[model samples]
Structure formats: C-alpha cells, structure tokens
Target: MAGARVDPPVHGDPATLGGYELIGRLASGGMGRIYLARSAEGQLVAVKTLLAEGVVSDVERRRFAREVELAQRIDSAFTARVRDADPQAELPWMAIDYIAAPPLSELVRTAGVLPASAVQWLAAGTAEALVTLHGEGIIHRDLKPQNILLPLPGPRVIDFGISHANDLTRTSLTLGTIAFTSPEQARGEPSTEASDVYSLGATLFHLALGRPPYRADSDTLGLLAQVQRGQLDLDGLPKELTALIRPCLAVDPGRRPVPAEMLARFRQSLAGLPVSQGGRRWLPQRWTDLIGAYERHGRDLARGAGIGAGATAEGITVDQRTGMVPPPEPTRVYTQERERAERERAERERAERERAERERAERERAEKERVERERALLAQERLREREWQQELERRKAENKDRERAEEKARERAARARARQHASGPSSASAGAASGTSRPSSRPDPARTPPPAPAPSKASSAVVWLVALAVAALLVLWLATWV
Candidate 1:
C-alpha cells in the first residue's frame, strides 16, 4: 500500500565486517547496502550490509539472521556462494562471490537476446542453480531478469536476500519487485516450488518477447493477470526451443515442466534430432565462414549491378573490389534534353493506354447490363404464357361436362319407354311362376363433343412472342456493338 521508499545511502566511515575489508559502496537498496570489499586473502567480494537500526524487535533480527544462514548454505557453482556473514554485528553484512559480468538485463539491452547457443548455456546453468536451491528446501522468492548475472562460461543466479526455506515464513509481506512476482506471491500466498517455476516463466517471457508479458500501470494488477490468464505468444519464436518454453509457461503449476526436465529437453532440442529438426542447425566453426562467403557474394553481385560496395573503416572490404571511389559525372545539356523527351513520350503512351482500358471496361459493363435485362424479359414472358394456357384448359373442361350431362338425360328417357312395353307382355308369365322377365335393351346414345373456343388468348401469346423477338434483337445488337 505504501509507495517505494527511497532509503538514504549510509555514508559511515569505511569499516571491516568479519574478515572482509570494506572498500567502497557498490550499490544500495531498501533491505541492505552492497559494498565492493576485499577478503583478508585479497579476493574481491561484494558485501551486503543490512541496517540494524530499524531491527528493534528480536523476531525481526532472528529472521534476518536466519536468512543470512540460509544464503550461506547454498554452494552451487551456478549461484554466487556466500563466503562470510556477521548477522549479530551493529550492521549485519554478508560477503558473496563478486562476479565480473553485466546483469542479464544489461546484456540484453546492449546486445540483443543471447544467440541460440548462449540461451542454451543460460538455461543449463540457471536450471542447475534452481535445482540446487530447491533441493536445499529454499524458494528463491525473487528470480527475474535483473537477478541473473551473465558470467563468461554461463549465467549465475544472484540475490537471495529475501529467500526462505520450506519451514520459514518470516516475511508476511511480498518482498520482490512486483513485475516478476509469481501469481501466488503477488496475492500474499506462501510460495512453493511452483512459484519459482512461475518466476522462471516470467524471466523466459522477457527473454523471448524482449519485454515482460505483464506490463501495466499497476504492477501488482498486471502481475496477477499474467499469472491468471497470460499465455506466451510463441508464433514467431524459433522452433527449436518453443516446445521447451511452452510447458514452462503453463498456467497450471502441476503442468509446468521441472527445471531438470526442461534442461534435458533443451539439450535434446539442440541435438538436431526429430524434436529439434524444425529450427536451423549450424556448426559454430562454419557460421562465421558461411557469413563471410555470403557477404562476399552479395558484394560481387552489387558490383556487377553497378552499385557501390559497402565497407568498414578497418580496411576490411566486404567486396573484393579494390580501387579509388570515382566521382559521378555531370549530365550534358543535350543528354538532359534527350532524357526529358524520352520520359515525356513514355508518359504520353501510358496515359493513352490507361484511357483505352477505361473505355473498354465501360463498354463491357454496359453490354453485361443489357444481357441481364434481356434474360429477365424472357423469364417474364414465359410466365405469362403458362397462365393463359391454364385459363383456356379450364374453360374446355366446363363445356365437355355440359355435353355429357345432356346425352345422359336423353338415354335415360329412351330406356324407360322400352322397359314399360316389355313389362306388360311378360306380366302374366311372371305372375304365374317365378320365371325370369325379359331383359330391357339399353339405348345407344351419341355424346355431343365440346366445341373449340372461338378464339385463343392471342393477346398474351402475341405479347410473349413479341418480347422473345425483342430480346433476340437486343442480344444481336450487343454482339454488333462488341
């Protein structure tokens, strides 16, 4: 909740802490002051002196002492080993291995991300240190870009001032820079092995993206969001190491690959095996020679193309050409006049071609429009003829029905007369015995045929035909225009 406190630098007279002779101030921070001091045996060491005036409580002093003892126990080559410490002194000071290399941040700022080989070395060394620290049951509460020092052979992890062991929970408040704190630490939760993994992921993100994944106005909120939802954008990352980095940045702590496993994967990736085949593989010995050959080839091509050869001031000519640079010639009045005329002629030709293209496009668009209109007219005419035919068929059906009804009526009357005559003659015989009566003959009736309609729906038909003829004419006209 408080703003970053700017602690004034302690400018006391130079004094020795333990056996190391204090020299001068190297750097200072809220918790302590680092001095460039010499060991009694003449070895240079960086001594971090913690202010004791503020440590009034006995518990705070004991916690500070415990931190010093924990730091002194770590003896890994990948880490800066503490040589000596005097926790009970008026100003507690601890001496650590003074490395002679720039911080990882500085190296990246000056020179870009370490080349593939350098990154591999860094991973191997850092992973080794992490394994050692975690094995000692210590969580390196702060592991970020600035804490990793780049030594000649490899990188060394430093700054274990706020580190604590598995059982120690002295510092209730977050101690490290907010940008690199793991999600758990940022939320004031006790840190674990997974927390260290999260910090490592943040560190790798910086290395890969050339910036922290979470950088907002509020460092605390940004870090929390990164811990919750951040995913490394590895789209353009070199293929060789993306596989190794993706798992390290897994949001789930259990999903994150262990440091040792990551190191092995990194080694396997570098071996140019199936897992590493996607990335480029080049021998260190041949890289420089290949680059030189490429540069020379480029220079020769440039020379052939009548371009200037680029070189450096060290007398190292990238191009094989060796001669005094010549001054450019001035154009003559007649030559200028000829160039001007040629340019004008070319411009005129270009303008004519463009105008012709525009006219052709316009004509084609108009022709297409005409064709579409003709197709629409043809469709409309076909629909009209179908409707007229349906109407005529319905009228014919009605006329045929009337003719059938009239014929049926005439046949029924003739059959009734015949039946009456037969019944009178057979009446006696039919009454005497159960004899069968003579059957009546059926009448032969001719059904009248329906007459044809006086006129066809010539109006609709004629209109349809006219439309078809018109469309055909329009198509013909379009072709002629073309």
Candidate 2:
C-alpha cells in the first residue's frame, strides 16, 4: 500500500492463498503479483506468488525457492522478516512483513533528496544492514532505493529477488536493476559482497543527490558502458560524503571496503552529527507524522498477528483461526546444532564486546573533558551575543534622540522666521512685488504669520497718502468692472 488504501486486485487474481485471504494487490512485477493479504487473525501480509495460470516451469520454481531460502536466512532487523512460504505449491507463494511506510525511492521522488543529516542517518542504517547481510553470507544483488522500505525506526531492505547466498548456488537468474547494478554484474561476472557495497554506495548517492551518479536517462548500451567504465556524474553530491562514497564505486572488488569497515566509516563521518532512528532531528515534522501513523498501525498489526501472543500446552500457539498448517517444528538434530552454534557465537561476541568496552571507556573520559571546554566556549559566545544586542539597542536610542532634537530645532527656526516676516511687513507692502514680476523673483519660504495692515502714516502725510490709496483702490475697482 503506497498510502492508506490498497489497490483492488485484478479480476483474474486469486482471492486467497494457503488460507490467507488476498484482499488487494500491492504491486505486479515481471515475476509475480504481490497481493495484500490478511491472515485469519486480521493481520496483514505481503504475499508474493508466481504469475502462472496452468503448469509452472521447473526453472521458475527453483528461482522462487532460491529467493525464499535467501530471504529466510536473512534475520536482520533492517530487513523485512520472512513470514511464510509454499514453494512446492501449484503457485509458489512467499509472504514477508507487510509495510506501509513506502520505499526510499518513492519518498525521494516525491520529496527530493534528503538533507545532509538525514543522509547520515540513512547511510549509517544502511551500512549496518549490509553488515548483517554480509555476516549472514548473503549479498543483495539489487540494493536500490526501490528495494528499501523507510520505516519510522530506520530503513528495511526488502525484495531479495536477485539476492544470492555465498554458501549455496541456486538457479543462475540473470536479473539486476540497471541504475544500481554493479560493474561486475554488468560484465556478467559473479557478484561478491563488494558488489553489494557498490550498490549501497549508488543507493546512498541517489538518496543524497536525488539521482544516481550515472545518468539513468541514457540508453541501455550507454548506461552499461558508463557503469563498466566507472564514469560518474557526481554534480550534486555533497563534498563531505565524497570520500565515504567514492571508494565504494571502485572498479576492483578487492579495493572496496567491507561491510563492517563501511559501517565504522559512516559512524565516524556522522560522529558529531546528532541522529535518531525513530523519525527524529533529521526528518521534518510532516514526514515524521506520516511515519508515526504507519508505526501505530504496525504496532496494532503486531498485536493482532497472534503468532507471539501466547503459548499453548504443546508449544508456541499457532493461528488456529486459520485452518492452514503451521510451519513444522525443527528436528532435534537441527535444534541441537543451532543451539551449539549460538553458544559459540555468543562467547565470541562477549569477548569482543569486553575489549570494545575498555576502549569506549577511555574515549568517554576524553570526551567528557572536551565537553567541558565546549561548555566554556558556549558561555563566551552567549556573552558576545548579549553585547551585540546591547549595542543595537544603544544605536536605536541615539537615533530617536537625534530625531527629537531635529524636531525641536525646526519649531524654533519656524518661530524666528515668523517674527522676521512680521518685521518686514511695512516694506513689503509697496507695489514693488508687481514691478519685480518681470524678473520672476523666487517666492520666499512661507511662514505662519498674519498679513500686517498698511502701517499708520505720520499725521501730516496721512491725508495725501489716503487720497493716493483711494485713487489706487478705485483704479483697481475699475479694472475689475472692465
């Protein structure tokens, strides 16, 4: 299911398989149709079955069986754990852990390349998964983003369609995803653990840069030629990750770093970068919310799976609700061998862990001292920040004070200009203004002042002045009448 709803299965598709009710189709590939099935206990599963109507071929059977065996051998937390299978049935079917979070390719195609910190989380988790796969002696021939499911906890590598186990050589199926295919695989050579490393590097490059280093738009022959030559288009790749990823793309398998080494390298690159597996600091809120919803659904489904709900008097409780036969108990011989191997593995792990613990303690002591120094530096930075804030405030206060002063000075200047205009009123009352109009004298700046009346004349001249003024006023009136 890409989102919440599952697409309805095609008409010809079977309604049920091995008693699991097939509700919808998740995907259809060249090999088979993957159906969304529900167990009798209401638990969901992804069931992969072949696409044969009548007689199934022997080669197809072996290929499907090989996939089931390889998938079952892988018991890693970063992979979708195999649940059930029936290889010899009329239509071979294998069921794996049902997931809803979506493939990394889908996420990237929709949301674009992740940020550096998120890429760190992705690289670290994928390396760890590879470590587990290499430890199990399995090489995932196809390790593209499309085969990776991004859960809230981390990425889960799925679809072991082309995976091969080192110890067992099964059907020689010539299948590979071109975008992430290794050079050796392109050259028709046997893929080794290093080939998986190369594919992982390609996948990480795609995650960090939105597309693989090689051009996917090129035709098949050109693309294969590019892969064979180790030519890359690393335009958008982060410089910091170039060292971590470049070695993986080496032409020689022997030169590439092993899974454990790769994991350590990724950890070192992300040492100071804070990361979380459970949809944290690296991922944005919206993506986290979607993951959270899927996580809740997964939890509910796990509770309802019933395989681990309780124990019966005979052995572990089977889903009796489904009439199908449960997987048979392991024989005593196999169980004894498995127990002995587990004990030996545990002893070796315990010894190695003790040695690691001692080195870790020393590192912690040095880290503690370094943290103290950082704390002091952080305090100094805080003081500097406060000083900057204070400086900004002081500048703001000075600007405000200057503005107020300018306003007061402007008021005083305006008052002085008003007083001067009042003093000059008698002189300006002459008709000289009209005489000066020919030269078009510049207008004086206006001020707040009342126009002064014609100044009172001396008594001797008052009569004559009045008569002249009356004549002027009558002449002005005659012009108005005209």
Candidate 3:
C-alpha cells in the first residue's frame, strides 16, 4: 500500500483462502501476494500465499510448510504471530496478525529519513525480534525495511525465518534483496545469524540517510561486489549511532554483533528519553499521522467486510480452529521489558535522593547564616552596655573630686577669718602700750565714729580670693568632663 490506500483485488485474485474473505491486496513479492482478509468470526488477518509460478520444485513447496512450522514457534510481540496455515493446499497459504501500519520502506520514502533517536528505537525493536528468531534457530535472510512494520505501539518484524529457507531451495535471491545482503552472503557463503545483523544495519543506514549502505552502483553485480568488499557509504550518520551500527556492517562476520548485543546498545541509547503511550514518542508527528492513515484504512476495510468497527482478532484462537498448540519459547520480550522498568525505577529513585540532598544543604546554609547574624547583634549590644557602665563610674568619680575641693576651700576661708580677728586686736593693744598712737587714725571707742578695721578688710579679701580660686578649679574640672 502507498500512503493510506491498499490496492484493490485484481480480476485474477482469489476471493477466499483457508475460509478467510480477501478484502484488499496489501503487498506482493517474489513469494506471493499478501491480502487483507477477514475470518468467519469477523476478525482481520493477513494471508500470505505462494504464486502459481513460484512453486516449481518439490523443495520449494516443502519450504512453505517448513516456514509455517518455524514461524509458529516464534511468539513474540515484536514479530507477527502466525494464526493458521495449510501447506497441503494447491497454493499453500499462512495467516498472520494483520498489522495496520506502514512499512518502513514506505515511511522513509514519503516522510524522509528518521532522526537518530527514532532510528535507534527502530533498531531496538528489530533487534528484539531478531533475538527471538535467532533463539529459535531461524535466520531471517531478508531483513530489509519492507519486512518491518511501523505501528504506533511498536515495530513488528514480518516475513521472517522464510527467506533463507527459500534461498536454500531456490535458484536466486528475490528481486531487490541483494542490496541488503551481507558481505559473506554476497560471496555465496551460507547465511548465518550474523547475516541478519548485517541486513539490519543496512536497513538502519537507509532509515538514517534515506539511502542504502552501498549505493554507488545501480546494477546488482556492482552493488554485490561493493558489499563483499565492505565499501559502506556512511558520510552523514550521527556519531552517537556509529558505535552501535558500524560494527554490524563489518566485513568479518565474527566481528559483527549479535541481535542481543544490538538490542542492548540501542536500548541504552534510548534510555534517557521519555516514554509515550503506545511508544510513539520516538517517532515524528508526520510519521504517526501516516500510521493513523493506515489504521483508518483497516477500519474502512472492516466496514466493507460487514464487520463491526471494533472487531479484532483478540478472542479468536488459531489453536482452537487448527488444533496446533505452538510450543512456547522462553518469554524474552516481557522479561526484557520488566528489566527496563526496574532500571527506570532505580534511576528515578536516585534522582529524587539527589534533589532531597540539595534541598537539605540549602536549608542548613540558611540556618547557619541566621545564627551568625543573631550572634553579631548580641555582641554589639554587650559592647554598648559596657561603655554605658564605664561612663557612669567616671561621672561618680568626678562628682566626689569636686565635693572634696569645695570642702577644702571652705576650711581655708574659716581659718583666715579667725587669724585676722586675733591679729587686729593685738595690733591695737601694741599701739596703745607704745604710746605712739597718731592723732585718732583709729576711731576711739568712746567716740561715736565707726571703727576703722583695715587689717580686717584685708583678711576678708584673702578669704574671698581663696573661695574664688576653688570656684575656678571646680569650673576647670567640669569643663574637662564636658
């Protein structure tokens, strides 16, 4: 199908195969045409059959039956699960789950190349499918973009474990399968598990660069020679993808990585990315829109088939209808998924612990700063209190010194007055005894005139000078304090 439209059944197409009604032609190849069909229970499925011209040898016919047997053993979510098949029919046919999605080849052709992360996601899913297929000892000789379906949920690997089986019994490779052939396969060496790895690398190279690994030559032989020589055209591949994809294209099969290794490497590359519902986050919106178109096409086909819009193949069982219980392999897909989930949980817990540590450190720093500020304020207050106490003590000492000076001045004044009184009386008596009293310079006691006490006046002036000196000393002391 190109874009969203499936090709209508041509005049030569069969209307029914293995009791399934053919709705539309999904694709056709050297093997045969794959048709969109519905079962009697109104469940959609894809039926693959061999063309009348393809069944030439008995070995080729047996390969179809062998393909059914091997494909049934593989029950992985990454692979298209087989539901029903009939190798005894004139033209053998097998029915698989109908994936309403676009082929990788079509998506890349219409929407251009995918991003490195999207390419890695695609590689992871394809490698997961390879891990399961190789576990069953099935080598998908044709691991190209056309055989991979890109759905919203995840990629599905289709038409696997049949190419190399057919190659062993056939005369040549299918049309256009040589482009993705490994170097050893190109040299006519028997295909191995590593051969599929090489093809997956080529497919990724195409998705990453919009072209195959060795596209220098248009002819098949020239391309085959380049592949054998390991001449890869990897000019623009992202460096992050090199470590994962480059080894797969190694000329030495021994040097190439197995599917499990590839799966691990690709998953590691995508671990830091966010997950989306249905796992569509890795793909671009344009790519998702195209996928939706394909799903709508399936719904449209269902309506034409007279089935309910929500009809699905969930309840229908191939084992019940065909009595074939496909021996279950080890559950690798769910195991890996569980491991991934555990790793993610551990990572989230680590991130939360780091965040909490940072917050605790910040709170401690803030508390330290607050305590330092309070201590600084207390130190300043103590300094001010000590200064105030010292000032009070100095003021008390100055007041006592001023009071002592005033008391000494008062005592000196009183002694001076007493001495002056005694000297005045003695001087008068001496003058009278010597009989040298000049004519009444001193007033007589009998006379009414006021006594002339000049000596007493001088003593009084001395007492006043002493008091003024003490007053001057007190003024100087108070000025010093101010």
Highest lDDT model number: 3
Judged by TM-score, which candidate is best? 3
lDDT of 3 by residue, 455-480 (tens): 68889999999999999999999999
Residue 44 lDDT in candidate 3: 83
Per residue, candidate 2 scores C-alpha lDDT tens digits across 1-482 of 12433356677788888969886655454556676688888777878887776889998788778778877887887777778999999889987778656567666766667776677677778888888877877777767776777777888776553334443333222212566888898787888889888998888888788777785444445567778788887887888788778888888889988778867866777667655446576776655655665556555434532122131112111111111112332222211354665576588789999989989998999999999999999999999999999999999999999999999999997997677665565544453765653421223335333444455657649888889999999999999999
lDDT of 1 at 312: 15
- Candidate order, lDDT descending: 3, 2, 1
Q: lDDT: which is higher, 1 or 2?
A: 2
TM-score of 2: 0.56
Worst 10 residues of 1 by lDDT: 317-326
lDDT tens readout by residue for model 1, 247-275: 66666677877788867766765575444
Candidate 2, number of clashes:
0
Screening candidate 3 with a backbone cut-off below 3 angstroms (N, C-alpha, C), the clashing residue pairs are: none
TM, every model: 0.51, 0.56, 0.58
- What lDDT score belongs to each candidate, Candidate 1 first? 0.57, 0.68, 0.73
Alpha carbon deviation, residue 169, candidate 3 (Å)? 4.1
RMSD values, in order shown: 26.4, 30.7, 24.0
